[model samples]
Target: MDAPSNVVRLPTAAPRKPNNHRFKEQRAAGYEAKQASVFRERYINPRVRAVMGDAETIMGIEQTPALLIASALFALADPDTQQKAMEQLAPGAVVGRKAHIQAIATMRRLRATTIGEQYDFYNAIDELEKRRS
Candidate 1:
């Protein structure tokens, strides 16, 4: 075992710990942005444009409502937020009733699983009617 005179042993470096936090956050943010873009392209923009219809109408109407609806749709994609929205809007206040109707319609159109079984469309309509009185 003494025939290794010409061989040199190299020292091994210590294993480096993975710093995944920054990369993970960056990746998550990127993925979220991409998903949001896709959602806008596929659903939000089309609906908003449909409501706008033409240049004159688009210029006449405020963009805030469409933006709010899109934001609500994004938030409603989360189950917890969807539940909170349902609870918050169930009391039939005028504004809440309108939001409830919009949310239900958006959920149905999107085929969102988050609020699939939870929202009652008829009850929402009744609440809206009550609020209108």
Candidate 2:
């Protein structure tokens, strides 16, 4: 039978109920997740209604491409260029070192892409294999 005399057993705790005891920030974020976003209502709707006379109007095919190109240009632009884009709200330099650097980088990337079109990776790999042998 049992020979141990110094061993002590303690009661185990129940599994943690994290959901039952969420932090204030976690609870607030959970509540926010259930709500619809007000982005269009706050920004897009007002401008669209003012210009087009309808907030429900769709950006048609012609406007869609222009919007896409504008987005791409914005993506390529630096912080200064992006700020100048919203010049009415926040005015600053028309161009800066950041803009110049981004422009040069974008042009270099474009040129590299154009050059990469003629590159034959399979042939290059074959040559590498021959060199290794």
Candidate 3:
């Protein structure tokens, strides 16, 4: 009878702890790249410029349909006229009423202007119109 025994030992290194900061940074970079599509340069960035222009003008206010729904009670009138109306409708709410009235007045004034009559709402977004096609 013959007996043979073979033994093999492999050295194993201690398990290394993951670098939390680097892992987080890599994860953040991946998240940012994924979000890059959420903010397309030609779309969102250009639209941001349009939004800024909208914020400056009366037409900008019209785009906020919700505000109109609430404030529809107010009619377009000059400031003095609005003050007189406010004195009757909602007696102590002077400043707030004035703001609503002023918005209405400005909106009406803008409507009366020649530019208002000629405004092509879609043309503002027409980048192609800038070129001779």
Candidate 4:
């Protein structure tokens, strides 16, 4: 019987890190798609459209949820801008009585979630779903 040789081999060079900038960019695109999904699910009905507008217009800055949310995030960092955006949202009502009140709140929460946070969140969600199944 022949004895087997015991040898340890180590790599001369480290493996290159997989560049995920493209993946991150894709995730950002997914975020945009989520915005569309929100509109489709929340503001889709014809009656809602009557108050909101068509899909494109309602999702537009002039009359879209994004504008309201974006404005709120901007306002969070800048009180003056927030006041202006609030005034624009509810010209007749009080300073904080805009239809975007919820949107602004959501934006505030979203500010804490950057692209990496979102990636983690999605992974967590997927794991939970798998466990549930």
Better of 1 and 4 by lDDT: 1
Runs of candidate 4 with Cα error greater than 4 angstroms are: 1-109
Judged by TM-score relative to the true structure, which candidate is superior, 1 or 2?
1
lDDT string for model 3 (31-101, tens) is 88867775553443443344333233443345457656534533444557655554555433345564455
Q: Is candidate 1 or candidate 4 better by TM-score?
A: 1
At residue 49, candidate 2 shows an lDDT of 28
| Candidate of highest TM-score | 1
lDDT of 1 at 63: 49
- Cα lDDT tens digits, model 2, 1-133, are 4637886444574444446554878878866864656553233232222333111122122345765585577667776765555453222223444434333333322232333331432233333445458
Tens-digit lDDT track of model 1 for 9-75? 5566435655668678889998888887846543423323333222222233344887568756766
lDDT score for candidate 3 against the true structure: 0.46
lDDT tens per residue, model 4, 1-133: 4335675344764456567676888899988888878465443333323323222222332546876676556746655655565456554343544445544433333444467545544444444445458
- Candidate 3 — which residues are off by over 4 angstroms? 1-52, 55-66, 70-75, 79-111, 115-122, 125-133
- Pairs that collide in candidate 1 are none
Highest lDDT model number: 1
Candidate 4: count the clashes: 0
What clash pairs does model 3 have?
Answer: none
Candidate 1 residue 123 C-alpha distance from true site, Å: 22
Q: TM-score order of candidates, best first?
A: 1, 2, 4, 3
- Stretch of 10 with least lDDT, candidate 4: 52-61
| lDDT preference between candidates 3 and 4, better one | 4
